[model samples]
Target: MTTTQSLPHWNMDVVYPGLQSPEFAQGFAATVKEIEALVQLFDASHVEKQDVLTVDDGLIKTFETAVEHFNSVQDHVLTLEVYISCFVSTNSRDEVAQARESELENSLVKLSQLDTRFTAWLGSMDVEQLIAHSEVASAHAYALRRAKAESLHMMSPREESLASELNVSAGTAWTKLHANLTSQLNVTLELDGQTQQVPMSVVRNQASSTDREVRRRAFEAELAAWKEVAVPLAQALNSIKGEVNTLAHKRQWESALDASLFANSIDRQTLDAMLSAARASFPDFRRYFRAKAQALKIPQLAWYDIFAPLGSSDRVWEYSDAERFIVEQFGTFSERLSNYAARAFSEGWIDAEPRAGKRDGAYCTPLRKDESRIFTNYKASFDGVSTLAHELGHGYHNLNLAERTALQSFLPMTLAETASIFCETIINHAAMKDADREERMAILEASIQGACQVVLDITSRFLFEQNVFEQRKQRELSVEELNGLMLQSQRDTYGDGIDQQTLHPYMWAVKGHYYSSDLSFYNYPYMFGLLFGLGLYARYQQNPEAFKQGYDELLSSTGLDDAATLAARFGIDLHSEAFWRGSLDIVRQDIDAFCELVQSQA
Candidate 1:
């Protein structure tokens, strides 16, 4: 068995020697001072809502100065926050890190207030005129315009300020509670005739085990452990969702989903188009699921079997092998991407181990423009290798945006998944090229499993969150109610592909996405990213040189425009169902091939 100690831990020393080091302390103090200076700048410039129709040269210069200052301060603030989050996320039991995070959040209330005031001021002024007059404003035209539009839903300055102050104890606290509880959670199971307790993340990773009994035991033990902590987790969910609902109402948004649409910089038409195509592909996904069940020689797939390995592989995907495979596959597309992956590996940028107190799942966060850290709970499986490819894709995206200003690189979640998914495809496709029949079957199964999650499972999550928000508006939902809603969502989307008796009911507690108050409806963007990426990959296949030349530019410009506008640049119509279906067709072809392989093997 691989221990966490053997796996690589990220090098935070490059960012700062330690959280308590003098360099970090100086940076933190300097950021606070900068925030104070920013407030003074805003006050001196009278950066508030205005009734004037046009701006003079003097006012334009003031606006430019304020924009530049705000951008600089924001960059520093994000770096500090990301640095703290690295420690807090890696170990939930770190009291000092948790305290520091809370203190930081509290300190930022004033900055958040200043942001609200600035947005309201922009909302009241002629943003287009300002953009025309100032070079800085012109460069940040999209973000400025977005702020102006968002200001329509803003509360009074005092109200917004108060909300920001209270969030530290309210929504943020609840989110922290959820993270701490889930990270520290442990499941007890009997393996090899001995009872052992393992972290919930470790147990969850067993879902892909080739042994049926191990998967079954892990799933049941996971549910039992969650049941023990369901009450507090339920309260955490209610609090976060309740806060989101109240804020959405106060801000005058139509619904939580409506607010999410604005946050993602996507319109309703785009969402509808993507979902319409996803719904149409449900029958095909079910076919793949049923075929997997047949290959497993099961009557129907249980929830535990969703990620079960479908074919045998004599080779174990150790960490070193995963590293080599990813770099080799990435080089097939572009040298820049390949070099980025190699740097991440050699520079100790990934923390790939599961252990007590460490968070579940995986994410890649930017430490600076040119650097990023990836976290994953790696198991010795192909899925683990694919996860590395996915996150390195995110790192590559960050590298492309290195030259842009902080505000210019603030991409919406919808486009954030593009590079990650694209990189994942590269690795999957490359692996298939050299594999023997059995190896090919394993690779294809892993590929389709990912698509099913993005397409089928993500639909269920979208439905579940939508229902939760709607019900949460009326009142708080109990644990049983949340579980029931989860089961209903699974049944609705999974249909007959999964056994009704074996559906996972506690999924709401298992997934961390639901516990975030700041980002709601975090589910659908993944679907958008998957389909969009596959579509881009198809485009790349048609014209490799042209696509390669423009790919980095597209990533670098994600924050510069809305998702639809970016899609238009590539001649992809986001509003057209056919465009999304084209992406789905790629997955469908894979499903067809998978079904044929399963049948032949059977």
Candidate 2:
């Protein structure tokens, strides 16, 4: 059994000794001072609300200095934020870290105000002429042009500043409330013939247990736990979405999703194409689900059975085994990647234990251009190994962006998953190559299960969030109403594959994605990443050497262009239904293989 004592806690000391340490205090104070200096520079240059239509030497100089100083200030702010988040996320009850985070957020409001001023000033200028004259502007031309376009959607400077300041207490507070509540939430369950109270993350992890009774009990306990906090979580969801809806309208967005599309650097057409393909592939996913149910000797699958292991594997993948396997598989793709994964392991960059007060789910957060930290509730299964590889992929992506400025490295959510999913594919494919029949079946089932969540389950989340946003426009939804919406979404996407009576209605409360005010519609981006990464993997198979030469550059340039432009570099038409269908075809093939394996065993 994996315990918190046995698993690694990340070495945050490398970033700072402690949140209250003298070094951290000095750094935090300096970051505040730097932000204030940037504001002074903006004021001195008269860069706010300027209506300059021409570019000259003085203008070029001001633009260059502002861009450089802004980027430097952003780096400092992000470093401090990420450092504090390391503690807050791992232990939600950390009052000191929470207080510091709030303080940092308050300081960041000024930076946000400065950004509004800068965007308005840049939007009013002759951006093309500025780009032509200034090296900094030219390097950030894509971002500048996008910012100028976004300026059309801005409120007045005062309103924008007020919104930024208000968000520190409004949206930010709600988001933090949900995080703290869920992280500390526990579920009562019976394990080893004794009753025990376990963290929600631990209970959730049992959904993949070999024992059906355990999965069912955990599911019930998990639902009850969520129910206990449903009212507040519902309020959190409503407040966040309500804020987003009001702001979207104030900014002249067609809807909240319209704003998200702009933020993700993708057009509606691209999203439509991808989602259409995903919906069309639902029947194929349903087929896989039915086959898995048959293998488990059930008429239909419960939500708990969705992640259940389908075949026996004698191999138990402990943390060390996962580390070694990921490093080895990554080497086959590139030595650079393998070395990076190895370094992540040796340097204690991963927190891989599920404990009380620790948040559920896994994420890879970049600490700097060259370093990242991965958090996961790792189980002793291949699924755990695959997750580790996925996060290392994110770290590798960060490394590629090391040469770019912070602004230039800020990739959209759609493209952000590219490297992680690609790395996960590498590990999955490698694992299946030499496995025995049973092991192969297990690996194939695991891979298909993951893809199903990205495709089918994520579709449900997308639907749920969309409905919430629409309803939030009128009034806040009751917890029961929210539950009903979740169930309806599950039925719509999962169809007959999952048992209707056993659908998970509290998923809205389970997922943290809905609480984020800055990023809406976070569900579909995972689907985009998976399909896009699979498409890229197919290309690599066709021409390994050619793909290798350009892969890192493509990853590096994600922030430099929109999704369509970046996709165009490899002859991928993001708006084409055929391109999306081709990617879904890859997943369909896996579904086919899974069905065959299940039938053969039966």
Candidate 3:
């Protein structure tokens, strides 16, 4: 009965009328006041601050009130930032959006120091003693414990403050420049005796074309575009990593990876275990890749051909049809998830159209209180449909945790993909079940393609970034050196599975991961999420009833515990190579089935 034709754009009017709106002015002024209030609360000279900090007769009441005010201020600041982000993402050429974004960044420059001091002070408190006597303490007990654990490496408040202020111009500016260059850069793809200028987003999406010629041309064009801008991007990567290395040293952390581990609420042992398993499982992955090459009638799979479509899986989905299908498919798993998808579609919570100046990738931004906005370049493909499911999965996760306090809602990135991947799996499985043989082959090929990207490609990224953090400490690397590093990483991870001559040497220049100073090694988390999510899916298959019982708790507890501890609650061992190896076993089985189908039909 629905007559929706075009994809839904997000309603930012509810957040603010516009950047020039008086409502925005009021929120900005209020935020400034709140920031000052929270910052002054941590000032030791203030008598009321001392009384509020101490465990006195009125300490519980005052401290609870203070935390509420702090959260309110943080929320307002974030709301404003999200508005700018949403606007700038959709209209990258809007200088006003970018300016306001920078203004908000400047306005909140004091946040880091304030937050560090507050967490450090909270760490110093008798959290157990306070929790026993205060209801508010009971609510934020885990966050306090986590803050105490993280405070082990807290720099002097002044030092932390200096680092925060320094990053504004140093790391932040470099990243914005990188973003600006990539978003605006156009790629010229020559095809069918004609050349077309397109955004990098569209050019990259062409890698999934069923036509081998188109895919190859798109890949070459993408590399050429990146080559033109690689030098500055190389410098950006070096400066960002160099800054992180310097900051990590100042904080007295053992390594940048150690700091990243702490931020992800995971430990080194788990990372080693995870990587070890991934490395050992490559034989199965190679088998899948080789089968894909066979399906494509190629002797060896070229890097450009990695996403080349195989079989008769050329179904182009309409946006509205995808919305309905995804909602119904989600119901197969949980009514709650299905309901969330329904709400997202009925309400305007998605921006799913390709446009000039729009960002390249898709993401779900969970706002607050059962609301989220999904951004995607939805071109009406099954893959786009799957992406919609993935993002909505994240929204559903947010919905489940909506009742938690602000601090408790800050889940680590490692577990952030759980619900999203789970939802994707559900939709993929449902599609495969109802699909014909050739379509089924396409589904299997698509699944393995995704696995390869996460497991193998992400491994290469982690290695490349780790090496850069080590080398950039000594000196800046040139564009040629960065390319060389990327080539070697691709070769090491892909081995002979990918065509050596056609490997993408400019991948480091194109990836957004290399530029994040705080979020170093953003690569391996994808591998972790993909495999771990499959492992959870396998468990659900075996015992849907029992698995469903603890699923809610698992998602809700993500912000409260370390990755290892949280997995342990579900009887999964994150520190064991066996656990991860077992997870990949699911992929191994899928490869077996896919290869069998290809050979059977050949």
**RMSD, candidate 2, Å:** 1.2
lDDT of 3: 0.81
TM-score of each model, in listed order:
0.98, 0.99, 0.95
User: Please, what is the whole-model Cα lDDT of each candidate in the order they appear?
Assistant: 0.90, 0.91, 0.81
- Winning model by lDDT: 2
Q: Candidate 2, which segments miss by more than 4 Å at Cα?
A: 1-5
Relative to the true structure, candidate 3 reaches a TM of 0.95
lDDT of 2 by residue, 124-149 (tens): 88888888888899999898998899
Ranking by TM-score: 2, 1, 3
Worst 10-residue lDDT window, candidate 1 = 1-10
Positional deviation of 184 in candidate 2, in angstroms?
0.5
The alpha-carbon lDDT assigned to residue 511 of candidate 1 equals: 90
Candidate 3 backbone overlaps, count: 0
Error of 2 at 461 (Å): 0.9
| Better by TM-score, candidate 3 or 2 | 2
lDDT (10s digit) by residue, model 3, range 551-597: 98888888876788878766898988998999888788789999998
